[model samples]
Target: MIRFEQVSKSYSGGVQALQKISFHIQPGEMAFLTGHSGAGKSTLLKLISIMERPSAGHVFINGHDLSKVNRKQIPFVRRDIGMIFQNHRLLRDNTIFDNVALPLVIEGYGLKAIRKRVETALDKVGLLDKARYYPNMLSGGEQQRVGIARAVVNTPPILLADEPTGNLDPKLSLEIMRLFEDFNSVGTSVLIATHDLGLIARMKYRTLTLTRGRMVQDGLEASGANGVES
Candidate 1:
């Protein structure tokens, strides 16, 4: 579970990216963050991942206050959260198996354990057959799936994706969303930041909308309107 209490973020130049944003994502829940560019969606995700610290207020993951977590403790905090990027950040020089196994390797897992977890993660994304292939050798969808596998290889309880389907076509986008839904069904809490309105419309999950650094709406599509005034 993640909770933000009157969180605000401002850069060195006094450029405010988020203004007193507050929301709570319950355990085993799935939600979407939708906003235009520079609307603070990515800033919110970075706060949860500890990539950026909030300038004011607090952010809690599971139960720990991230504002109190020091630099040395960030890595351990991140181990409980999985992150996916739009670009599918992977090592082109490495094989698919190596890319997905990087996290476990960094954690110093045994070879047998790494192999078992890597294969299982790849299998979940339907990319087990491409284990030996390099990232450049795979299609965009395949590469994204590999990224998803890498994100989940550690079996993190929470998943955060930023513009996960930004570069894919509609068909591929739906495929990627389905994978997230599958993960949520098994009890993982998911928070995705995206600008794809069509995709958001297709999914009935709760959505929070941001504008000019303020959270303007939060509701579900089933409640008549996709979002209610905040």
Candidate 2:
């Protein structure tokens, strides 16, 4: 679960990306962050991942207060949270299996465990046969699937995706969403940052909309209950 109380983020160059934002995401719940460019969706994700710190209040993940979390413990916290990126961020030199196996390998998981987890992750993403293929050898959709596999390989309790389907077609985007839903059904908390309002409109997940770096609305679905203004 994620809880942000009066959180604010101001970059070094004096640009304030988030302004007193506050919200709570329940454990095992799935939500989408909706906003236009510079609306602070990515900033929110970064705060939860400890990629950046808040200029103001607190950001709590599960029971950990991000502001009070130690530098040495950031890694341990991150291991329980998975992240997916817009570009997949796969290493061009590594095969799909290697890429998916990176997290476990980094965690010092033995070869056997890595192999089994990697295979299972790839199978879930429908990319088992492409395991031996390199990033350049797969289509955009396939590459993203590999990224998904990499994120879920560790069975993290929370999943944060930033524009994960930004590069894929609508059909592929739907497929990826369904995959996230499946993961959520198994108890993983999912927070997806996406600007695709149409794609989000079709689903019933809670929708958080932001504008001018502040939360404007938190709706239960496509309902008119949530909207913040510029």
Candidate 3:
């Protein structure tokens, strides 16, 4: 579960990226984040992932307050989260299998276990046969799928995607959305940040909209409200 209580983030130059934002995402819930460019969507996700700290209030993840998470415990806390970026942040030199297996390898899992998880994840993304292929060898959509597989390879309970379908065509975007839904169907808490209004309308998921770093609307409070245009 994710909870933000009166959270605000300000940069060194005195630019505030988030303003007194508050929301709670329950376990096994799937939601969407929508806003215009520079609307604090990325900063909010970073706060949850601990890439950046808040200047005010608190951010709690799975019952742990991120404000009190020490540097030594950061990695352990991050292990419970899986992040997917808009850009396919794949290691071009590594094969798809190795890319997806990196997390397990970092955790010191044995070869057999890493292989099993990597293969299973690849299969889930419909790319098992492409395991030996490198990032440069795959299509854009395929590369994105590889990123998704890598993120979920370890089965982290919370999934955070920042503009996951930003670079894809409409058809491919729907396919990628469906993949996220598949994972959500299995109870992985999902929060996706996107600017695609049409896609948001089609999906009909609870949405949190930000405006100039302030939370302007939350679709959760209104039944059947997709979201207001940012």
Candidate 4:
């Protein structure tokens, strides 16, 4: 569902975040992105979400070319993508129900529809009982799950998570990853950007490794292959 062809992203003053990165993630596929601190994983996700335009080459979601998308068209394109961040990014003052309902509300869904969708998303994340609770009342894992629910409330076809498990313990991390697996099983394409090598090794999914802003490895661990490195 995501294709990047010779994509490069350079900021002002000659700071390059990505250098000619090319990769395609098929629909319903689940993959992990791993790299060092400055390897451009975040930048790559931003480009896909159209938060930043490419300096060169192209980024395509489904069959839509992002470079050709105008500013007015960006929101429409984003409706198909759900984004999760390391920090939950919830509103401190909002209840869980309100938080999860934000996307649908923004999309102008009716009150009845928003309530149903928000509850369904909360149920998926095992947070339905906490719907009336504020984010501050939840544990770290629960808070992150709330973030997940908020992201998926719109039922977007593609999900992109950036360091999603960074703040959780290994057990909580596994729980969170399993939730992503569950979503992937139902045909939502999942791309997770994480630095957890041990977790990646255990999960045995296809992994894309980056180094110095370039893709260095793309391999499936189940086959014991190190994949191509450039």
lDDT of 1 at 28: 97
Q: What is the Å distance of residue 183 in model 2 from its true position?
A: 0.3
After superposition of all CA atoms, the RMSD between model 2 and the true structure is 1.9
State the number of backbone clashes in model 3: 0
- Model 4 scores a C-alpha lDDT of 0.91
lDDT of each: 0.92, 0.91, 0.91, 0.91
lDDT of 4 by residue, 1-230 (tens): 99999999999999889999999999999999988778899999999999999999999999889999999999988888989999989999999999999989889999999999999999999999999999999999999999999989999999999999999999999999999999999999999999888888899898888777888888775223243222
Q: How many clashing residue pairs appear in each of the predictions shown?
A: 0, 3, 0, 0
RMSD of each: 2.4, 1.9, 2.1, 2.5
Any residue pairs clashing in model 2, and if so which? 216-227, 216-228, 217-227
Can you write out model 2's per-residue Cα lDDT over 1-230, one digit (the tens) per residue? 89999999999999989999999999999999988878899999999999999999999988778888899999988999999999999999999999999999999999999999999999999999988889999999999889889999999999999999898899999999999999999999999999887788888889888887888888865445345322
CA lDDT of 65 in candidate 4? 91
Please write out the lDDT profile of model 1 over residues 112-197, one tens digit for every residue: 99999999999999999999999999999899999999999999999999999999999999999999999999999999998887
